[model samples]
Each structure stands twice: as C-alpha cells, then as structure tokens.
Target chain A: MIRFDRVSKRYPPGVDALSDISFEVAEREMVLVSGHSGAGKSTLLKLIAAVEKSTGGAVLVGGQNVSGLARAALPYLRRRIGMVFQDQKLLFDRNAFENVMLPLSITGFPRREAAQRVRAALDKVGLSSREKALPVMLSGGEQQRLAIARAVVGRPKLLLADEPTAHLDADTAADVARIFKEFNHVGVTVLIATYAGDLFPGARRLQLEHGKLLP
Target chain B: MTAWLAQHGDAVRLAMRRLASAPVNSLLYLLAIGVALALPAGGQMLLANALSLAGTTSAVPHISVFMAANADRGMAAEIESRLKKRGDIKRVQFLPREETLARMKANPGLRDVIEALAANPFPDAFVLAVADERPEAMERLAVELRQLPRVEHVQLDSAWVRRLDALLQLGRTAVLVLGVLLSAGLIAISFSIIRMQVLTHRTEIEVSGLLGATDGFIRRPFLYYGLLLGLGGGIVAWLLVGAAALWLRAPLGELVRLYDLTLVLQTPGTRDSALLLAFAAGLGWLGAIISLQQHLRKS
Candidate 1:
C-alpha cells in the first residue's frame, strides 16, 4: 500500500525529477508507472521505497510517512518491500542460489526454511537449473530471473521493480511479466516502473511526462 | 537464541572464507601483528623474571653496622648490645673482625688478596635484621646507627634491592609503553585491512543495504575478520614467546649461575595467554568498528 501526497523531488541545480506527484495504490493492487526515459518513473518508485527522499510533500507506505522515518527505521520499512533496480544489483561473486538467499539471510530466516524458500522462488522464476551458476556466467534473461527470485524470496508484501524487462527478448519479458502477475494474483502489492507499458496492459497505469503526472 | 547463534555462526563462517580466499595476505598480516606483540610480551616476561629474582634476594631487610677500623671488640660488643635493645631491630649478629677475615680467606679469589695484607683490615660489625623494610625507616635507622660511638659506617643492605626494584619498575613502564604503541599499530593495521576488504566488497555491501540489511548485519563479517586476525596473531605471539623462553632457558640459567642467583625463564602461563588474545582481539574489533563507521557514513 503506497500513497504520495503532491510529492516533488528536485535534484541539484534546480532539476525537477518529479513534480506535484500525487497517487495512491490500495493493498494487493498492481500498478504500472509508465514514463519516458528520465521522466520520473524511477524517482516515484524510489520515493515509495524510501531509497530517495522527496524535496517536498510526504510519501507514505503502509500508513507510515517514510520521508520522516529515522535512518535506523528505514531498514524495517525496506524489509517489508522488495526492490528490483534497473541495473539488476545482483552480487556477481555469489551463485544464483546464494544471491537469492541474501534477503532471507538479512531477515535471519532459519537456514533450512530459507533454503527451501529460495529454491521455491527460483523455481517460480524458472531459474532452478542455474542455481549454482554465478551472475557473470548466466545469460541476460537468467540474470533477470535470478534478480526476481532474490526480490521475491523473502515474500515481501510490496514489490517495486524498475525496468525489470529492459534488455529481455519479448518472450522472456512476457515470462517476467507473468511472474509479477502471478505474485500479484496471490495478493502481493506490485508497482512496476517501465517505459514499455504494453508489456503490462490492463493494469492501472500512471503516466508521467516532464516530471508531471498525466491523468 | 538458536537463530541468533545461527546468524553469528554464519557471519563467522563467511569471515573465515573471505580470509581463506587471501591466505598469503592474511598470513602476512597475522605475522606482522605477532611480531609487534611479541616484542612487548617478551619484555614483560623478562621483567617478571627480574622482579622475581629481586623478591627472592631481598625477602628480609638487613642493616650492617661496622665498627671503626681502630675500634676494638669492646666497641663492637657495645654497639651490638645497643642495636639489640632497640624495638625496630629484629635480630643482631655480632661478626668479629677475625671471623670476617676468615670468611674472606675461604673464598679462592680473595685468598691471595687477603694473604697480601699485613694485618686484618676487616672491622668488627653488627648485622641487624630490621622489623620495618620501608626505605625511609631503614635509612633513618642506618643514620641512627652511624652516630653510635666508634661506628665507622652503617650499610643498609636493602639499598641495592631498592635500586633493583626501581630499575625493574622502569623496565615494566617501558614494556607498557611498547605494548601501547604496538597495540596502536595493530589497530591501524586492522583498520587498513578492513578498509580494503570493504572496498572490494563495495557492490555486495550496497546490494545488501538495499535489500534491507541492517548496519549490524553489514558490519558483522568485517568485525569477525578483524577478530580472527587478532586471535591468530595472539596465537603466533604466544608461540614465539614460548619458543624464545625455551631457547633461552639453558643459557639464562648458566648466566645466573655465575651470579649465584637461580632464575628459570617461565613461558607465558594460561591466564596471560588468554589476556593477550583478548586484548589483541579487542583492538582489532575496535579498528573494524571505526572503519565501518567511516565507510558507512561516507557511503
């Protein structure tokens, strides 16, 4: 669940990343933020995750004002919401299984349970066979799938992904979109930021241009 | 509790694996720490032995009151009687000049020197074991004994003990200073090592942070790495000091034999070894914490 109240973000030298952005997503809802490159889709998702703070107005997630949250409290907020960055921030040295195991490790999940969950998540993302392969050894689609497995392994209530299928073939992108839809079908709130709105049709869409939200 | 322990165990294992990945670098760091620590630890061991020797030689303080060379046995007897009457004097033994000369002549090196003298140059003396061993009290008693009639000089035998004790104190202070400086060096080494590790793992750390890893979680492995380095160094230092003590035992025993002082070079005992390990580990942990704080703040 996320709510943004007239949120505005300005970078240095007076560049507006997001301007007068106000939107709300109900629990268990799937929403797509569609925007052109450098059109503030990433900034909106980052504000919801508290990865970046708004220059003005408040961004609320699960009824908590993340903008006013203390630094120590940020981790708790983040742990409840899984994030997939555009760059696919997977640890290269770790195998696919180990990369997926990171979130559960951070939460101190029991080793046996964490292993099981990681396997199940990998299976869901179609990455079960490449569990032992390092990120560098995996194909682009496999790496994207591995990143998704990692994001969903902890079963976070809310998932935010930025350009999850940017470099994938249409078929692989469709598979990735299907995995997100599957998670959303199970009552997980999902917000995806992408320029390719066609990949996720029939989902509620918020379009942004020049840092302004379009109705 | 099990989960908490499991988390810590995981962290420790990760740290060990990272260290193992760079065996040569890790071994070199440990050796540097060991050599730095051993210098002070060895100095402390020698100082302990010296203090022990001093303790054995000066268990009881004695003052020797000598009669003037021209004075006779009657004057010595009188001085002995007066010394015995004092409450501070525990016991007094009269040493006649003839007995002193005889004892000197018994020494093989002094025999020829004594035979060269025309008459016994030895003076009659009273050896007093004093009740109080304090330096001021002993000096005061010695001054009092010197003022007695026909007394040539009063020697406080504990003066050499005091000097030896002072020298031992200085040695202890020097060892403490060395230990402190080396500890700083150890801490700096840990800091630098951890800083490099953090940099190498920069991407992993950033990913972990984004994945909701706490500060403690991010810091745990690095802390354990530093701790292991220090612990390994402590073990190495203990071995070095123990080996040195063993190697020097025979030669040191022979050296002390010439001085008629029996000294055995004892290796660091269990408690000392534990303390060394704990101190080194603490320093390493401190360095790791500081490095993490600076890196985290900057990032």
Candidate 2:
C-alpha cells in the first residue's frame, strides 16, 4: 500500500514541481499515470521511490513513513519499492544477467541465490535467452524488459515505472504493460507514469496536468 | 542480507568485476600512489640509519672550564663539587695546570714551547661529563658553570655533538612536514582515482540505485578500491625503504670499520611496519570518506 497525502514538492527559490496532492495506491493493483511533459509524473515516482523527499506532507509505503527516513536508510526504503526508468540505466560494461543481479547485491544476498533469482526474473520478463547480452546489443523493447527484470528481482512490494514503454513499438508496449499487470495480480502494486497514447484499459488511470491530477 | 552472504555472492562478485572493468586506470592509480608513498618513506629510512650510526659511536660529551689567574684552589674545588652534586650531571674532574701542560708536552715537538713558559700559564680547569649526550642539558650545565665567580672561561667540546643533534632535529622536522604533505598528496591521489571510477561507472551507480541499492551497497567496491591502492602504496614504500637500507649497509659498515666501531643500520622495526600498515588502512579509509562524500551527494 502507498499513500501520498497533500504532498507538495518545491525546488529552491519556490518553484513547485508538485503541489497539494493526495493519492492512494491499493495493494496488488496496477495504476497508469498519464501526463504530458513537465506534468510531475517523474517527481511523483521519485517521491514514492524515496529518491527525493517531498517538500511537504507524508509519503507512506508499506505502512512505513518514508518522508522521515534518514538518507543512509533511504536505500532500505527503496529496496521494498522497485523503480524502472525510461532509460534502462544498465551498466554498459556488464552483461544482462549481471544487470538484473544488481538489486539483489544491494541487499547482500549471496551469489548462488542471486543467480537463481536473476534467472527467474529474466525468465519472467521473457529475456531468459538474452542474459549474456549487453544493453547496447539488446533491442529497445528488450532493454526495457531487462530494466523491469532488474526492478522485480528484489520481489519488492511496490514497483514505480517512469515511461517504461516510451520508446517501444505498440505491440512491445502492450507486452510490457501485460508484465506489470501480471506482477500486480501476484500481489505487487505497480505504478506506471507515461504520456504514451496506449493505456492498459483494465488498470486504474490517473491523468495529470501541470502537476495536478484531474478526477 | 549480510546473513544471506551465500545467497547474494554472485552479485557481489559482479560488483567487483564491474570495478575491475578498467584495468588500465586501476593500475595507473596503484603505481601513482605507490610512488608518492615511497619517496618520503625512503627519506625517513636514510635519516634513521644515519642517527643509528652517530649514536653507537659512543663518543664522550664534555665541557672544559678554565680558572682565572688569581683564582685559588679552594674556589675551583667548590665549583667542581657543586657540578658533581647536580643530578643533571654525570661526572666532573678537576685538572691542574701542570697536568694540562704535561699532557700537551707529551707531543714530540712541544718540549721547547713548554720550557719557554717560565711558569704554568695555563690555569686549572674542570672537565665535565653529562648523563646523556644531549644539547639542552649540556647547554644548561655550561650556563650554570659560567655563573661561578672564579671561572674565567667555559669552553664546551660541542662540535660533533651539536652537529649530530642538529641533523636529528632536522630529520624530525622533515618527517613532520613531509608526513603532512604526503598525507595531503595521498588524499588527492585517492580522490582522483575514485572520481574517475565514479565518472566511468556513473550509469552503473544510477542503475543500482534505481534498482534499490543503498548508498552503502553502492559504496562498497569503491571503498575496496581505495583500500587496495592505499595498501599497495604502503607496501611499495616499505619495499623501497628496505632496499635502500640493504644497499647502504655494506658501505656504512665499511666506513665504521675504519674507526673500529660496530653499528647496524636502524631500519624501521616490526613495530614500525605495523604502524605503516595502520597508516595504509587510515589512508584508504580517509580516501573512501572523501569519495563517498562526492558520490553520495549526487546519488
């Protein structure tokens, strides 16, 4: 469960990126955040991921108040909440399997179990055969799947995606949305932020404009 | 999952591989840090050996006090007694004018010159020895001895003593200043190496952080990199100092043999080596701290 209550994020000198927001994401549900450019989609995801704290109000993830967490422990908060970026952000120097294994390493899981889990995650993301390939070698859709595989490897209770399907073709985007839906059905809450015309209609849709959400 | 070490072992290994990706850069930093540490360490070993040689020579440090023309034996005796009673002093002896003239005359060509001196022109003198051959104590003794009423002159046999003392002090000051300067250099060395690694691996860091890696997890391998460089540099320094010490041993021994004195070069001992290891660890830790400040700031 994730909740943002009257959350307002402002940069220095008072430029409000997001203001007076209140929202709740239920457990095991998939939600699509539709927004145009500079609509605060990424900022909202960053707040849930604990990458950046909100300037005001509470951010609660999995019953833990994340807004008050110390910087050193912010990663622990993130560990429970997975994040996927538009840019895959894979270490170009490493292979796909290694890329997926990153989050497991963060929590200090040992090699054998981490390898096993990486394989399972890759299989789930339909990249089981591309484990040895680099991000550059993979197609756009493949790289996005690799990013999702890496995010879900930790078995996080929550997943936040910022434009997960932005660069993919229609069919590929639909496939990616299906993966999020499947993960949600298995009791993991998923949040996708995108301006893409395609929307997985069965999932909850939140349209945002200029940092405000329209009912 | 520190307890899940067996579970997440591969990812940790992968992290290490990720750092080792650029072998050329790592090697370059290792060599740079090693050379920086070696230079100062070699200088310290040279000074240590020199001091050891000066010490074991066991030469005496003494002061000579010449009495006034009208000074009587009683006043001279009083001054000697006074010096002897002080704990700061080890021994004091009064040499009469005749003994001094006789000793000088023991030379083959001094007979006529000594005979021309109708009476004993040289005054009675007190020759003093200190407990330890140090300048400050000897200087203080000289000061007190000169204050005596009957003494006309206080001449210290201090040429070699003062020279040795000055050299040792200069070495100490050098170590102090150089240690600080070298430590600062080490900081810069570690910072650059880490900064480069961070730059090359920025994508890796971002990906890991996005995937839920904490600041600590992100920092581990780089911290290890700092340690590796620091320890490597320290080992190189020790080897350099050790090799120089070995090279100088023969020539130093030969020189001392001509004077019939036996002294070994005082290389930094085991305790010193342990200190070097500790210093290496400290250098690595300090470097890691600096790098973490920058990385975590952005992450």
* Leading candidate by DockQ: 1
Give the local distance difference test score of model 1. 0.90
lDDT of 1 by residue, B113-189 (tens): 99999999999988888888899999998888878999888888887777887898899899999999999999999
Poorly placed runs, candidate 2 (over 4 Å): A6-21, A35-38, A52-59, A63-70, A195-199, B1-20, B60-159, B249-268
Model 2 misses residue B155 by how many Å? Answer: 6.8
**TM-scores of chain A in all candidate models:** 0.98, 0.96
**Model 2 C-alpha lDDT per residue in residues A1-215, reported as the tens digit of each score:** 98889998998998888888888988888888888889898999988877788999998888777888887777777788778886667777779998888787777776688899999999999999999998899998999999899889989888889999887889999899889889988989889998763667777888888888788
lDDT of 1 by residue, A13-50 (tens): 99999999898999999999988899999989889878
Question: Model 1, which residues run further than 4 Å from truth?
Answer: B112-119
Error of 1 at B159 (Å): 2.6
Candidate 1 reference-contact recovery? 0.79
DockQ list for all candidates: 0.84, 0.49
What TM-score do all the candidates reach, one by one?
0.96, 0.77
- CA lDDT, every prediction? 0.90, 0.80
Best by lDDT: 1
